[model samples]
Target chain A: MLKINNLSATVDDGNKTILEALSLEVPAGEVHAIMGPNGAGKSTLSYVLTGRDGYDVTSGDVTLDGDDLLEMDPEERAAKGMFLSFQYPLEIPGVPTMTFLKTALNAQRRARGEEEMAAPEFLKKARALAKELKMKPEMLKRPLNVGFSGGEKKRMEIFQMMMLEPRFILMDETDSGLDVDALRIVADGVNKLRSPDRGMLIITHYQRLLDYIVPDRVHVLSGGKIAASGDADFAKKLEAEGYDAYAA
Target chain B: MTHMPLKLENLPTRRDEAWKWTDVRGRVSETSAGLSVAGLPKFTLPDGITVSEVETDDLDTDSAMAKLARNFGGKVWAVSVPEGFSSDTPLIIEGLNRGHIRIRIDIAKGASLSVIEHHAGDAGGFVNVDMTVTLKAEAKFDRTIVHNDPADCVRIATAHITAWNDAAVTQHALSFGGALSRIETRLAGMGKHIEATLNGAYLLDDKRHCDMTSYIDLAVPDCTIRQAVKGVVTDKSRGVFQGKFHVRRPAQHTDAEMRHDALMLSDTSEIRSKPELEIYADDVACAHGNTIGQLDESALFYMRQRGIPLAEARALLTEAFVADVFDDLDDEDLRESLLGKIREWLKEG
Candidate 1:
């Protein structure tokens, strides 16, 4: 379970406050979707939760399983079962995808006081997962996200999320660049990871993505605050009518 | 053999444009005051290769260092590869505590040879090495030079190579800088249709200094050349790369590219590069690029976000930055060994 109480954050070293005393909570065994228009601080919320630099949290408390998440480093937050699917995945040249994945998995395990996975076991798991995701084996050998298509990049991000199996997942605008087929495949990957012990907060601008994953609750974010909360029908109504009335 | 006193004043100084970033004169004066010759280390040649000790009288007198190496009273060890002979085994020549050495390698027509020269010594002293490599028509030669000397020692080496018609020559050099280490290479392409590649890299930390200066001449028609040099400097270390390519008027269809990239891990670290092209030919493809920068911050953040610690992320990026230069080596074990050395060096910082 993840809880954010009165979470307010700023950009440019607190010059601009993007999130104004925003509060939200997604309990375990639930999927929450935050539907907001452009500049509604959806991405900022994800970054602040993940402890990325350049985002100053003005005042807020973010706890995961009753543990304060704000006091940890980015990697520490990651090891504590937090995963963020970036809106724009980074291209890390010279590091093969397989190597990066293995390192991430092992590093997280090590941080959690678990034994490192052997090479053969890691390879087998990676190969099987990659094949299921329709990714070529050679793609795993290339540099991470370098020269990959937009669809391929999104698929790779989901592949990593599936492999790491974090306790709390933040899908930041995961539906922005994906086509219908890619959206379906990515949604399927996310759907398969759904469980009673894991919580997911999906952020998107449109309601089309909700049809695939079918969130349990939908929160409309406007003016850096949750303006409304409703069930799955709220997403369809907002998509059909738009967020103009909800704008501040 | 008589021991000649080195004239420090005659050495190249920083006032010279070519040696501006490298204070060879000052370093030599400070370290070569009480330098003495140690016992020459013996060399064992691989099978099918012949070795002979020759006189150093025929060496070129282009610079003070070359002249010093020629007149230093050290016997020139020459290795010859007969015509049409090819072998995968590499001949290794090591300079362990040897004061001065002159090496000459001659490959006859259509022969192939590979050589690895390692310069290392634990005792604090001066090392001078001069080598001449001649490749006859249709010959192929590959050479790898590794310089890992003592922290207190000063090493100066020069290699002059000549490639005849249709000959292919490749040279790779890696230097973990010492108090002052310099490797200078001069390559000349004679006759037509020759291919040559000059690759070098340096990893330096602390107050160490390493300079790689090269001059390649494309004299005949249809010769191709490539030069890629990379460096990683941390702490207060300094690295320098000066490369020049000259395409003569007769070399009509020449193609050459030179690139030098460096990563400065610390603010105090320094990397200076100068890539020059002199073209007299109307039809040639010549390009040069140089960049000196720190690691990509976003890339670092991305790696860290994936759970890799800061130090590990930095080491990974640094290794990736210098990995391409070693990708051309044919020996997998040697390549991995060199990469492992690089990784170890990165961890030390």
Candidate 2:
């Protein structure tokens, strides 16, 4: 469902190249994990895919469901079923969490020529999801991610992902700031949303997250390219050792 | 000795330190005809309130614009609230559409009142208003000014407020600019343990201009003062904010803070802000903050990435930035009305 061919990118016209001729594909009904160390361009790959600024693609072709994703703006890509769970979720002051969710949902629906959800229906679904995610309902009333704990923010991300219900999901360093318990809860939420028609890319440096939501395929990213590909066991072996050999 | 009809020479110029940024003298033509004596404003009073004309000759003031208002305006319209009078409904003051006008409002001891001054005075004419409000001991006064004028008019409205011991004073003003418009407020804390809050917001579009200037004095001990003003300037519009908090030596427990924040949306749009705190009391806590810049790009990108269009995202962020000033307003309906006006302003162009 998601394909990348010969992706070569730079840091916005800079001399340094962050992504080499890297190529990877995740088919429908599967979850893939990209494991890399610091400076391995793990986050850069997610940002480039989601059409964030400050990154220039020198030569690459990315397609989602056979549609050219690179040509679309960030919002357009979002409306086309692309979702990025940011490594560090921003604190958008004055925008209530529930209101933001409703807006995002409606905007995507509007873009896709679907009817907007009514307030009562949206509230009912949101309240149920908040309970299942173990998030306090009151947190939804506060400004989006403002004054929320690290665990709460990660949970909120999962909450948003569930609300938007995108076809392609990019989980960028989702476990960076989460504790063990929060990691379990977040992983459980992701596991419940897994389906045969959706594709998931989990980007992380450690194998701890894979223990909860195991990936179908694991790729070792080194020097901005896929150095190795193996089954989910690869993640356990790399965790025992380290990225030292891959860093070379 | 001053003449009957005030000439344009009586207006303050850019050379004057107070009107440096807002130059009425330069904007008004020198060869234009002088201003004549004008009548009082139309008032929609609540129960137990009446208006009477008092001679303006008894009023003496330093402000050049106020002096012009007193001299050209024939009399001061007076409105008094009886002792211990508290009302759930606000007293509405309207029809401040033209000419020079002066008003004096007195709140008796232990009384509470709310005043809504609606200014839609955007005719091709010039308007000058001088208003004074005095609060007796332990009185509570809430004043809200909603002003919107188009690009063809010039307006200057100034208010002088005095609060006695243990009195509570709250003022909130929202303005959409005229050709050249200014809402100036000067508040004095006259007794012990008084609390005062002065907050305002302005949204200027096109070639409209609006200036919100306030001076607060904490003259007595144990008085607390808070002031915050937020503004947004779009297209070729200009928004100005000047706020100062003065704490005297005798006001030992004085706690005052002033904040002025503005957002410039277009390349040609302009925003000028000055927030000052002058404290002579060694034991007092006084602070001031001022910022003039565009909206946060990171925040904008975040919102857009969530599927909101760029323009909608910008409007939402701008609304939130300007909506913070009215968070403490006691009247929920009035607060929502102000926010609705802000949203309407954002939706236009």
Candidate 3:
């Protein structure tokens, strides 16, 4: 449902390119993985896709379900069912997670001319989802992501994604800071949410996460573009041999 | 030294030096009582505080100041702890005023109390209040000042605090309304082992203006003062903050710190801040900082990426920014009321 055609982008105007002629496609009902080394423009891809201000799209078109994504602001993208799980989730002090999540969910709903859900209904749904993710109810009582450990922060990201239930989500290095247990739990959360009508582009540096949530397709991103495409076996080989094979 | 025959010609309230930026003397001349305040809300507090003031519009300024300046002609309406009476319920006091309000509150010695003062008005008048707090030997006190009035009202408040030997005091001031508003906290540390924690937050919108000025004097040895002030400015609103920390030569072991941060929501919004530290003591720990900027774009992006709209994200960040001032409040009910006002202000901001 998401398509990137020869997308070349830079962090700023006339700056060094972060992504050069990078192109990828994730059809509906598919899960794609982009594995790359550090400074390999993995996060840049996420920023460019989400239309963050610093990322300048040099030459390319990003379309979501055949609709131009570049013309939309960050909030517009969110309204159109777009989500990005950041590598480092911001710690918003004094903003209770419950209040923040409801505001977000309702904003998305309001943009689509839907009625806002009552607090009781929201609490019911949120409490159930939080339980399934093994997140303590008290965690949601605190400020958004403040004082949460690296693992807890990643889990909260998944929790937020679950609450949004978006059509497409770009998870950028969500597994980097997570420990083994956290990775397993996070992988399970992602797997549980996978559906044929939804799409996700999982970006990471390692293939260990693949063992838990196997991808339908693997794209090796090197030199700012997808150099090779294959099945999950490609991920296994890349894990074994590293990016030297793709770099050459 | 002040009289209030509040004239409608003073619409913008910009007639005095302190009211230059926040002129409410001309634009408007009346206050609208919110639904909540009109009910004459009374807080449930401890320490047997019976403070009930009926607001009356007295057109004559000089006569009103002379009569109400000493607290409505009573026995100097003071709060005492019987030298050792300490109930942790937190002393709560409410004052009702319509036109010009003048009141003075004094806290007794060797006592500990948390007091919350709230001002709600709808008229284009003025409120001049003076609060003097004295901390006896080894005494302690904590105070919170909550201000929420419309753009047509004016509140010029002064607080004078003196901490005796081994005394500790903390003051938190939160302002969200007023046309030409200025709250000054002047503290004198005359006692050794004295400490003061001062924090303030203000939000200005429309053509609104708010000023917060503080002066803490370390007149004795081994005294410490800590201050932090934050503000959010929007519309064509303007705000000013001036903070000064002074340490005398005899205050050798003095420790003081002051920091101010401001957030401008609109391009035309204005923020002015000045921080000064004067220390003649040989050994003292003093630091001060001032920062002014717009909201964080990265944080906004991060919030929006998770399905939060821009406005919602901005409100969340603004709440977080100002909530820091209310951290030291020991009373729960008063804290919640102030926090609720903060939420409403951000939504309207």
Candidate 4:
């Protein structure tokens, strides 16, 4: 389970508050979606949850599986099964995709007191995952996201999620630059990882992504707070009617 | 002039324009011990090549270090490659540990040769070397310099090269710095249609210092030159790069580009880069670029978010930043070996 209670955050060295008294919860085996318009503090919430620097949490409490998530470093949070698929994936030149994957996986495993995966076994698992995602084997040999297209970067993020197998996943605008076919492929990859032991928090601006990956609950975030909450049908209502009614 | 043992005062100080960044006189003293004053370096010559000693005190350059080598080094070892001669194996020169050494290489017309020179010195020693290379028409020369000196050694190595028309020259250098070290090269092209490439990389740590300087003179038309150098410094260490391309008025069709990029890992680490292009011809294409920066923060965060630790993330990013300098090497084993050294340095940092 993941919980955020009265979470308020200030960005740019506390010059301005982006998240204000925000409260939410996502239980295991459930998928929750947060829908909001521009300047609704949607991305800031995700960044705060993942422990990115430069975001000061003035007053709030965030926990995963009853453990304090706010006190841990970003890597520690990641090792504790917190994953955030960035809205704009960064380009890391010179680090091969395969090498990056291995380093990430081994680090997480070591942090959890598990033995490192064997080379052959790791390669076998990676090759199988790449095949399932319809990614070329040669793509794994290139530098990580150095020259990859938007769609390819999204797919690579999902590929990493599958390989890491985190307990909680946060997808931040994963469908922004993807096309219809590419969106479908990314959706398929995400849906395959859904299980009763994992929790997911999907943040999107449009209901189009909801059509492919249905959510159990939906919340309308406005002015750094949740103005309304309902079932999946609420997403359709928000889509039909703009956020003007929910504005703070 | 009489032949006398060179004194410590003969070193250049920061007052010299060319040695401003690398002050050899400011660091060494008369009481510096463990000075290895030895004879010439051992060379493993391949077939079609011969080495003979010649007594010579006529140095060509005005460089302070080269003059020290000329005055201290009694004779110069001349290595000659006959006309139309070619070899599959590379001639290897053992590491220069101490003393002053002078060498000259001559590649006759239509001849080709490759040389690998290693520089590793003893503790508290000051090593100086002066080398000259002459290439005739259609001659090909490939030179690789590898420097891994002791942490307390002060060393300087200079090479002067002359190439004729239709000659091809390639030089690659990798240096793991010492207390204070400098590798300098001067190339003069005398004919048209010549091709030259100069690429190098340096890694420094633990207060070590290294300076890589090169000056290319293109005096004729239809000459092309390319130079790129990458450097990484950590733990209060310093790295320097000085590159210049001088194109004369007669070299109308000349094309040249020079670039120097460096990465500073620690706040205390320093890097000085200067890339210059002095072109007298208006129709030529010449460009120079220099950059000194830290690793990308966004890229570092991305790697860490994937569960890599801070140190490992930094190492991976740095290794990538300097890996492209050796991309054009023809030997796979040699490339891997060079990468191995980089990886080792990254781990230690």
Candidate 5:
């Protein structure tokens, strides 16, 4: 459902190129994991796809369901069914988690000519989802991610992903800073979102996360391009070995 | 005191450091021609409070504006809360026209009260208000003053407060600037173990100007004072905040902190802040902070990425920036009302 063809991007006002003609595709009903070493443009790929500022896309194209995604604003892309679970979720002070969720949900709905959800219905759904995610109702009342622990932040990110129910999901280093228990809970949340109609791109440096939410296809990212493509066993091989051989 | 004639020209000019940013003299000279005193709205006191109109020639002629108010023959209104009485309902005082008003409030010993004074009018004139509040020993008092004047109107308000031993006083003021608006406060901690909080916010747009100036005196031992003032300026609006904390020699264990933060929503918007501490006590804690900047860009982007439009994200973040000023307020309805007003103001642009 999501395709990136020869995507070349730069950093620092084009002073440095992070992604050099990188190409990848994740079809609907498939979960693709991009494993790479440090400075291999893993995070850069997510940011570029999400249209974050300062990461200029110098060439190539990205499309979702045959619609051009690069031409839309970040929020427009969000309304077009693109979701990014930030590696370090921003602590937005003053915007309560519930309010943020409702706004996001309604914004996407409104963009698609759908009626806004009533407060009661939205709260009911949010409370249920929050419970299933093991988040306290009180946490939803606090500011988004403010004062949240590392695990809580990761869980909240997944909570948002589940609530938004986007068509394409981008997980950037979702395993980092998570303990074994938190890893399981987060993996369960992601696993529940797996469906035949949605596509996911899991970007990570380690194979520990793959053991929980195993990917259908694994791609080794080296020097901004896909160096090797394999099945689920490739992640285990990288974990036992390392990215040193792929660096060359 | 000398009976000098009150003249608009005698108002503090921009050359004076305290009035430099506000330019009150210039604004008065330009807008004082049509100034007149119109009828005032009737005030209804809440439970546990009494109001009486006192006929007295005694007036505080401390400044040119005060002298002008005295010359207008304004009646003195005294409001008092009896000793040992406490009430949850706040006294609501509304100002609806251009006039000179003098009010004195007495919170008797062991009494507690909350007062909300709202000022709004459509008259294209000026209003001068002088208020004095006395909190007796062990008394508690909270006051919030909100100004929503028309664009052509001008408001000059001054308040003097005295807190006795073990008394606690909190004052919050929010001003949506008119053509020219200023609120000056002089507060004193008269006895030991007093606590005082002074918080204010100003939202100005277009060519409006608002000035909040205060001088607080910690005269007795073991008193604490907290002051926070925030402002948002847009278009050609101007915001000024000047606060001074004085710790006397007898106030040995006094603690005071003052912070002033402003958000400039437009390049032409101006904010001038001065927080000064004058201490004669050797064992006192006093500090001040001032900052002026725009909203955080990262926070804005983060909100937008979550599907919130850019404008709405900006408004939410700006509202949050100034939300802490009202944290100490206990009235939920009033706090919501004030926040609603802030959101309305943010949506105006």
Candidate 6:
């Protein structure tokens, strides 16, 4: 479970307050969706929670499974079972996907005081996961997202989420720019990887992604903080109604 | 032997066939002839892999061939690659005169060898370092040459690799130094199947110039050659890469790929790449690519978003850009050393 308390952050240097004293928590065994209109800081909130830089933490405390997530390094946060599927992931050429996945997974394993997985074991698990996700085998050979299309990039992020088996994941608009079929495939991959001990925060701009990976709670964000919170039905109402009233 | 005179005729300079772009004739001080090699630093690798020298001018003075013997006179180094030689022992051969340093390596057919020739001296100095690698048919040679010498330094390092049937030669050259440094590599592949990869990385700063001109000759069948050169230039520094993969008619089923990618860190920095493939036969899959530009701003923004400071991000990207050249280097110790030097350079740049 992830706990966030009194989070207020600003886009560094500028007096721009992206998150104005927002606070929310996602309990274990549940999916929390954050939806908002343009410039509502939905992505900023996700970034802030993940401890991404640029957003100066005006005042905040974020904890994962009772451990302070804000104080940890990016890799350390990752080792503690936290994942973020970025809206625009990096394209690392010449560094194969398998190498990246193995490095990240091994780093986590090392942090947890576990024996490093051998190359053979790593390959076996990766191949099996790719097959379940319907990922092309050739993808594992290429550089991480080097020449991947938009849909493939999203799919690769979910694939990492599955492979790492993160205890908590922040999907920052993982559905953006994806076609319906591609979105369905990605959502299915995320759905299959979900577990009772894991929690997720799916950040999105549209209501369509909520249909596949239904959230237990839907929060409407406006001006950085949560403006409205409700059950799954709130998503349908917003889809039919739009966030015009929330902005007001 | 050519006398070590202050004014020697036909001095090798920028006008020579090998050193056309870098002229070092008017640079060397007259006091250089007396400069002692005794004070040169020595490096001891972690393992007991100590480097010893052998002289050929004592044994076969007349039998010495071409440039190796002409400048080499009687000096030759027969480096003994200890059995199961697997450490990252980078043999350093710095502080050289216009004379040559020819090292003949006997890497037992299946053995692995990583030879790193590092150059560092005064500006306007002409140094020729030649290394002959004969992989007895099945040996693996991961050779690397790092040239971080002073600007106006003219350097011609020739590496002749003969990978007899089924041998692999992963040849890497990092030329971050030199006013005009060029690495020319000539490889003969396939006594069976040789995997010859020729890669170069240069970081140009303050009008420094570099060139990696190589020729890969695939005389036999089933040989694969992959050549990639990446550079980062600042100020008015220039980077040039001219690579040619000649696949003869007898060399069938050859797979050769040559890629040149460079990043200009400053507005005045320039890069010129010509990747040529001259194939006399049709049964080969060969491709060449050249990309010259700056770092991707989006990637920079992304890394900055992750809280890695901008300077650190640039260093990391620069490292990652050139790190591919050493990805296949068989020696772990040598790889780490090269990476360390590159990281240091990135920090300052």
Q: All candidates' lDDT scores?
A: 0.86, 0.88, 0.77, 0.89, 0.86, 0.73
What ranges in model 4 sit over 4 Å off?
A: B1-3, B33-39
Best by DockQ: 4
The runs of at least 3 residues in candidate 6 whose Cα sits more than 4 Å from the true structure, single-residue gaps closed, are A177-185, B1-4, B8-98, B101-126, B129-155, B158-181, B184-199, B202-228, B232-260, B263-349
**Candidate order, lDDT descending:** 4, 2, 1, 5, 3, 6
Q: Where does candidate 6 chain B have its weakest 10-residue lDDT segment? A: B33-42
Docking class of 3: medium
Instruction: Provide the lowest-lDDT 10-residue window in model 3 chain B.
Output: B32-41
**Which wins on lDDT, candidate 3 or candidate 6?**
3
Model 5 lDDT tens row, A19-111: 999889999989999998999999999889888889999999999999999999888888889999989889988888988889888988898
The better candidate by TM-score, 4 or 6, is 4
Clashes of 3: 16
lDDT of 1 by residue, B1-349 (tens): 6765666776678998877887767776444523434326456677888888875477565776667776663677888999998987888887445466777889999999988878785556777777789999999999888888777777777888999999999888989988888889998988799998889889999999999999988879999898899999999999999999999899999999999999999999988888899999999999999999999887777777788888989998888889888899999888888888888888887
What's model 1's lDDT at A232?
A: 95
Query: How good is model 3 by TM-score?
Result: 0.78
Per-candidate TM equals 0.97, 0.96, 0.78, 0.96, 0.93, 0.62
What TM-score number comes out for model 2? Answer: 0.96
Q: Put down candidate 4 lDDT per residue, A1-248, tens digits, no spaces.
A: 99999999999899999999999999999999999999999999988998888899999899999999999988889999999999999988899999999999999999999999888998999899999888889889999998899888998999999999999999999999999988898899899888999999999999999988899999999999999998999999999998999998
lDDT string for model 2 (B48-76, tens) is 88788887575635888877886787778
Cα lDDT of model 4 by residue, B286-332, tens digit? 98889899998888788888899899999898888887888887877
How far is A33's C-alpha from truth in model 4 (Å)? Answer: 0.7
Q: What is the DockQ of each candidate?
A: 0.76, 0.70, 0.57, 0.83, 0.66, 0.10
Which of the predicted structures, 1 or 4, would earn the higher lDDT when compared with the native?
4
Task: Give the alpha carbon lDDT tens digit for every residue of B212-331 in model 6.
Answer: 878788888888888888888888988878788999898999988999989888898877777788999779999998998787766655444333445755776677888887787766
Could you tell which candidate, 1 or 3, scores higher by DockQ? 1
User: Model 4 — TM-score against the truth?
Assistant: 0.96
Task: Place model 1 in a CAPRI quality band.
Answer: medium
- In model 1, what lDDT does residue B305 have? 74
lDDT string for model 1 (A26-127, tens) is 999899999999999988898899888899988989999999999998889899999999889999989999899898889999999999999999899888
